[model samples]
Target: WKQSHDKDNTNRIKNSTENTSTICVSVCVFLQTILVGDSGVGKTSLLVQFDQGKFIPGSFSATVGIGFTNKVVTLDEVKVKLQIWDTAGQERFRSVTHAYYRDAHALLLLYDITNKSSFDNIRAWLTEIHEYTQSDVVIMLLGNKADMSSERAIRREEGERLAREYSVPFMETSAMTGVNVELAFTAVARELQQRSVQQPSEPRFQIHEYIDAQKEKSSCCRVF
Candidate 1:
C-alpha cells in the first residue's frame, strides 16, 4: 500500500492498507536505513529499483561517495518514511560513507552472490557497522543479483550460515528483476515499528543515544 516517487512529493495521498500518507500522518515513524558493502554489489541498483520503479541496466558504475532517497512504506498499518542511504563501497570513500552510519537504524549489508570476495568481505562491513551503530540497530545481510542464477558463486546456505553467525537476518534479492525488493526493506521496518508499538510512551529514538548507550557498555567492560 506504498510506493516511491523521488521527483514528486505530493502532500495528499491514499492507500488501501493504511488509508493515510506520510505527509498527512501526524503519528509516523521514520527510520534511517543504509546500503553498504563492496563496490558493484548492486546497492545503488536496488535503491533505484525500489525508489524509482525502474532498473538501470548494463555496466552500472559505483556510487561516488553517498546517495539517498526516500520511500514511504506501510508496516502493520503504521506509516514509515524510510531514508535509505546508498553509500560508496570503495576504500577511498570509506571515510566519507562511514560518517553516514552514525545514525542508521537499519542497515542493508549487500553482497554480490556471484563475487565470492564480496561475500567474504561482509565481515569488514560488519566491523564498520558495529563501530557506529548500537545493538538495537537492525542488520539485514542481502545477497543481491539473484537474477544471475547461473553465475552464483555463493550459495543460499552459505549466506544463511553467515547471517546466522552474525545473528542477522538474510535474504536474496534481484534488483534487475525486482525480486524480494519490498520484503528486504519492509522486514526491517516491521521490526522497528513493532519496537515503537511496544514503547508507545517513550520518546522517539535518537541516534546518538543509541550509540552512546552501547559505547557506555563497552567502556564498562573494558579492562583497565
Candidate 2:
C-alpha cells in the first residue's frame, strides 16, 4: 500500500548508487524510521550516538531538510536494517518533513526534558503524525537530554503520563551519556521485525528513494 506515489521513481533510484546517502547493506529486512521534534531537542545527536556509537556535542547543524543514516541491527538472529530520517524542526521545513510520514514504518518523537516548550510541542507533533502517517506505523515518545536532570523542566512522571495517554512507549534518553539511546531504537526495531514476521504476505518495504549524499545536509534515501 505504501510507495504507491513513487513506484515510477524506483528503477531510476536503484540504478544510481554512487550518489545515495544510505548505508547500503544486504539484510533480511528493512525498517524506515523517522525522528521528529522541536529544534535543539537532540534528535541529531541521538541519531549520531546510536549510529556512530559516540556523541559529538554541537557538531551537527540543524538539519536543513533532513538528515539520513542507516544501520544494520540484529534481532532474534535476523538482520534488520533501519533507515533513520531526521527532519528539521523549524516551521519552514514542516511541509518538507510532513511528506516523509506516509512511508515511514515507525516514528520516534523526541522532546527535551530540560525545555518545557519542547514538551508542550509534542502534542502538535503527534497531531501531524496522525494526520500524515499510516495507522500501522509504530510510534514512540522520548524525552531527551536526560543527563541534564538538574535543568529538567519536565519530570519523568509527566512524560510517562503523556505516553500513557497516547498509548505509545516512552523513554528518557541522553545523547550526551548514551542512556537508553540504543534501547529505544531496539524496541522500535523489534516491534517492526515482529510485525513482519506476523504478516508475511504484506510487502516488506514501503518505498525506495535515493537522496544525493551531502555533507552537513541530509537527503531522503530510504531502503524500506
Candidate 3:
C-alpha cells in the first residue's frame, strides 16, 4: 500500500536532541547513501520530493551525471546528515557512476512498478552494488510510482519476495504524490544507525563464514 505523507513525519529526522548528560554534547553522524536504478525509474523525483517537499511534474530530463543533496535527519534519537548521491541510470554513465559506491553506508536500489523491465534489471544493479560497495552497506529495495497503480506491471508480492531473498528493506513510493517518501528515507537511516551500533568500527563488517557442511549459498552477501 502507498503511504500518505505527513509533513510532521519529517520530525522522524530532527536536529534537536534531548539533554541528558551533564556535559550535553550534540550528536552528529554522517551517512553516505547512493541511489541507483534504471533510466526512468523516478530516482531523481524521489530525491527532489524528499529534499524539497514539492513534486516537479511532467517528463523531467534524465540526470546527466551524478547529482547530490543532503538533509539532516534524526533516527533513533541519533542525528545524521545523509549525503545522498543520485547517480545517472543510463548505461553510458555506468563507468563513473558505479565508482562512488565504494565506502557507501547505504544503497537504494530502485525500480519502477509500472515497468516490468525496470524491475527485471534490479538484479543487475544489485550485482553492480555488491561489486563496488561495501558488502555490509545497508540496502533498500524501493519500487517507485506507487500512485501509478493502473500502469503497474510489478506486483507488491514480487517486490517483497525479492527483498526477503536478499534480506534488504523494501518500500513502494510515489514521488508525485509524496507517498511514503519520508518513510522510505527514514527507514534506511534507522537501519544504518542500528547497524552502526552493532558494528562500532567502519565499513568492513565481519560476516560469519558458512559451515562446510551447508551446501547452500551464504545467506550473507559475498561474491562467490
lDDT of 1 by residue, 1-224 (tens): 12332112222112311433435465488788999999999998999888887788875787876777778887657778887888889998787667768778899999999999999999988998999887788898989999897999999999989987988877788898777677678777877876767666876644334433434554332211
Model 1 residue 108 distance off true place after TM-score fit, in angstroms: 0.3
What are the lDDT figures for the candidates, one per model?
Answer: 0.77, 0.79, 0.75
TM agreement with the true structure for every prediction: 0.77, 0.79, 0.75
Residue-wise C-alpha lDDT for candidate 2, range 44-156, written one tens digit per residue: 99999999889896788788766568688988788888888888999988877888899899999999999999999999999999999999998999999988988989999
- On residues 48-134, what C-alpha lDDT tens digit does candidate 3 reach at each position? 999999898875799875766777787657887777888889998887677678868888889999999999999989888888888
Best by TM-score: 2
Residue pairs clashing, model 2: none
Which residue runs does candidate 2 get wrong by more than 4 Å? Answer: 1-25, 199-224
- What lDDT does model 3 reach? 0.75
Candidate 2, run of 10 with poorest lDDT: 207-216
Candidate order by lDDT, highest to lowest? 2, 1, 3
Winning candidate number (lDDT): 2
